[model samples]
Target: MIIYDLACTAGHRFEACLGSMFDPNPDCGCGASTSRVPSRLNLGGAANAGPGRDDMPTTWHGTGQGDPATLKAWHGAMTKRERLEERYPELAGDRRPILAHEGAFAGRPLRAGDDLVPTVAKAAFGKEES
Candidate 1:
């Protein structure tokens, strides 16, 4: 989506998001016609290619290369487990401990119902696991 700063005939200014810059101006609340104007978003920034942002994509966790939701869920589960263990030292649980190398998806331990990343599962337990 593209956002543009627009000005109406009545001198009112507002921003609108459009699928393309060539789209017609949107109606203003003042019942006046509007025209697209220059904005900072169209300037040189995140949307444009640059020396640092042009680097090749990577494929690892902790390096901006993996699925963010999976990574977040994994860490959330790990943090919850840690808090539980801290609150209840004598709580009865499996001795395996939450280990990432066992059945983790991204970089954290897998919970009771979490599934591993497809490639990671296949790599850890062959194609059948995937």
Candidate 2:
């Protein structure tokens, strides 16, 4: 199955998996008929090509790992977070991890009820971790 970007007359956009020979037209969540929309080619890296727009990038090679010259220039001039915000303006002031960097778990192994939400919540509210 191939996934294609689709949009309805009402301006809703979504994706659907279809057979190669199957009709491209599909119904949108708003119940409006949809048509195929232009999508970017994803070479695969992180973040699933991001909304499939021409202006948006399909891959992100992290903040300090893209071009050698860019990295060299940013070395003493910008922090990783600063560079990230510069590259992706939408993420400005966002305090979430750009990518998964799961550090080594301490103490006992996590049980079924364990999760990382509290850790995030604590940081968000300025509460120190227990």
Candidate 3:
């Protein structure tokens, strides 16, 4: 999928995710034909930096790892609540809440309901162990 920034003849500006670049122009909803306008995408640390666009990122490294909330923002996901619901569908809308850090499960394998704290993990498991 691709997001196209479109501007209508009636002066409406909007974006839509379309299947292909060659796909027919989508209606601009203002009874006018929309034209694909230029936009910048900053994904995986690469972006189109050209004369028309500002906000050129000077420094961006590979993937980042830190607090779960920051990671969620980097993942471009919604709030912690929504991500947890998506990852654990049965727990959706639970009156009880799970914080993002807790959801990380501290490097444990996913969906197994088993985890270990750092100190305990170092003591009980070895590097070669799965």
Task: For residues 45-90, write the lDDT of model 2, one tens digit per residue.
Answer: 6753222122222344643347777556545344554566678887
Question: How high is the CA lDDT of each candidate model?
Answer: 0.63, 0.59, 0.57
Using lDDT as the measure, the top candidate is 1
Q: Which candidate, 2 or 3, would have the higher TM-score against the true structure? A: 3
Name the regions of candidate 2 deviating beyond 4 angstroms.
41-130
- For model 3, what is the error of residue 36's alpha carbon versus the real structure, in angstroms, after optimal superposition? 0.4
The CA-based lDDT of model 3 is what? 0.57
TM-score on alpha carbons, each prediction: 0.31, 0.30, 0.32
Task: Give per-model CA RMSD.
Answer: 15.1, 15.7, 15.2
Once all C-alphas are superposed, what RMSD does model 2 give against the true structure? 15.7
Ranking by TM-score: 3, 1, 2
- Candidate 1 local lDDT, 10-93, one digit each (tens): 999999989886788899999999998877654454642122211323448443567777667656655665666667655425
lDDT of 3 by residue, 27-121 (tens): 98878998998897666775422221122122343223355555555445334445666676764533333233333335533232334355344
The clash numbers for all candidates, in the given order, read 0, 0, 0
